[model samples]
Target: MTPREQIGKQAEREYILHGKRGVTPKNLAHKMGVKLSALSQLFPTREDLILEVYRINVQEMNREREEALDRALVDSGGKPLSIESIMDARILPLARRCIEPHKGVQYQVGLSRFFTESSSIKNRILHEQFADLTQRFIDEIERALPYLPREEIRRRFQMTMAAMLGVCGILDMAAYGKEPARSEQEMWKMVHDLRDFLCEGFSAPVQDRHSPSSIHLNDGGRQWQVPLKDIACINADGDYSRVYYASGGCDMVRQTMKAWESIL
Candidate 1:
């Protein structure tokens, strides 16, 4: 490798091993058997070196994730990808890569510190780098969802990201605060549930009921007929009851449980 590439790899290793606390160009130079002046001439400043290492590390992670997604596409035999497959291809590989024992914790704590540093230049560059990656992820989502309008695709993408980040933020804060190490199984389950929610939110609306049922119910002073299987549960609210159905809507009745049962 070239001297600059060598410097970057060495610096990244040192940063990963020692984290943000003990990493310095002087120490790195000493470890590399080079004078501090030579390292400074190559990297210009300590911040420059740190930024390069950080960028390279993040890029490598993204590269692996993209490869995993590509493999999934190849295995699908050219069929339109399901939303669940898309979500798994996007998230599960990264989770597996990062969830290895101490490595995961080190990466989490180290990167969090790197981005949230008060140093203006470092913070700005890290923000830009991450924002670009996030936009690329959204673009991929849009491409996968050919049935959605452009605006709808963008909206879903934003909500998907928000949900994932919000959940992750909660876990990170708890773990960093030394509450406990959250179970990876639980985290994956939460992500799977989020995937289901995103699929429901983004995909086409279900077909409206056309067939009338023998079971009749009163809603808003008008009688409506729905199948018994469509009724999920009855929610009692004070003097009234709300009947939740499986067809993505609910109906409110002006009668109590006893009254409704008598009619049945």
Candidate 2:
């Protein structure tokens, strides 16, 4: 490899492995097994290396997206890709890969701070690159009931996002607060129920002229169950009832999976 090219590769390795922002030509020289004086022939400044690493990440993310598209294409046997299905099949999984749990508190601190302070960028990136990931799910709700209006779809989307954000934010707060309010199981239940409730509201079909009544159990906080009839399925006012406490619509919302296992 040319000395210039080898220096470039070394700089990327530093950034990816160590998050080193101010990588000097000397640093790259050390990393690439070359003398500092020799390395300066091609590169000298830290920003040059920083800019290169940033461009590399963008390129890698695009390439990964392309590969995901290729796999989806093969899986579908030549079927056209829709933004929604591609998200479900690829983007969500990719996001999960970004979070790793290993022997450190820094990740928790960093991720929590990002969500709290930079949520707009975070949301925009997710929305734009994920091809309306959350929106695609919301669109599913509208498709489930063809007669639903666009405004209602938008409302349900907002409610779902609010509920998701609430779950993500509150659980982290609980982790670091003065006292943990509930065990992991209980916390999961709350989030699950919150999501289920939102989805049920979105997917409400034409109410049976006589929607059969079922038992209502606060479930002793074990499993919050309100019969299928009670969720904020359709609103005359066109607002999603996820935040509306009166609907008792826990059936459609997902409760924590752990709770069900314990109950069984």
Candidate 3:
């Protein structure tokens, strides 16, 4: 491999073995039998090296996911893709990777950490890639559940992604012996269980039980009921809260922010 690729690979290995914080320039250079100055010559900054590793791993993971999706499409034979199939295409690759030693899942965990804690430029680049991947999943959900509203589809997509990330996090801990690792069969079972749960959620009718359809507000002697969905946002104003609706109307209710938090 080229010097840059070698450094990137060594960096990834370090990250897998010791986590992101361990993949510093000195450690990587020592691991690769090179001087720190030489390594710095290839990557001017530590962030540059981290970003290279991130790009390599993320691109490979995305390629695998796309391949799985293509296989699913081929199997469908022009039929509409079922939620199960789409989910399998989306999730199974990551699940498989979670079992592989010192790779895949670890890389994902590191990428997530880097995105949250890295510089603004790095965060922006990662966000663009993440947003693109997210949109792809959202688009697949939209296709599977055409009857669902766009907003509902996006919400379900977010929930599904959150669950997937949760799984990754758990498996990552298990890899480090911080948590128990499941057998291959058990891991596959968990994957299917998650898929089944998400499918049910996506197929179910939208019933937002958390947010009341309308809330009653007593303003002076006049009492008015407003739809919670219509409210764009709520602002705190001393003891009272100002509620702004998407329709451009505002109301000051004799409710504290704490009360609005509970009611909303």
Best by TM-score: 3
Please give the CA lDDT of all the candidate structures: 0.67, 0.49, 0.75
Clashing pairs in 3: none
How many clashes does each candidate structure show, in the order listed?
0, 9, 0
TM-score of 2: 0.37
- What lDDT is reached at residue 34 by model 2? 81
Residue-level error in angstroms, candidate 2, position 132: 3.8
For candidate 2, write residues 214-261 as lDDT tens digits. 433332234454554444432222221122234453222233344333
RMSD of 1: 13.5
Q: What is the per-residue lDDT of model 1 for residues 183-225, given as tens digits with 9 covering 90 to 100? A: 7666666567767876777676533234334467776679877
Error of 2 at 244 (Å): 31
Prediction 3 TM-score vs. true: 0.70
Cα lDDT of model 3 by residue, 78-118, tens digit = 55688888788778777777756555456556646754555
Error of 2 at 40 (Å): 15
The regions of model 3 sitting more than 4 angstroms off are 35-37, 101-116, 119-122, 172-181, 208-264
Could you tell which candidate, 1 or 3, scores higher by lDDT? 3
If both were scored by TM-score, which would come out higher, candidate 1 or candidate 3?
A: 3
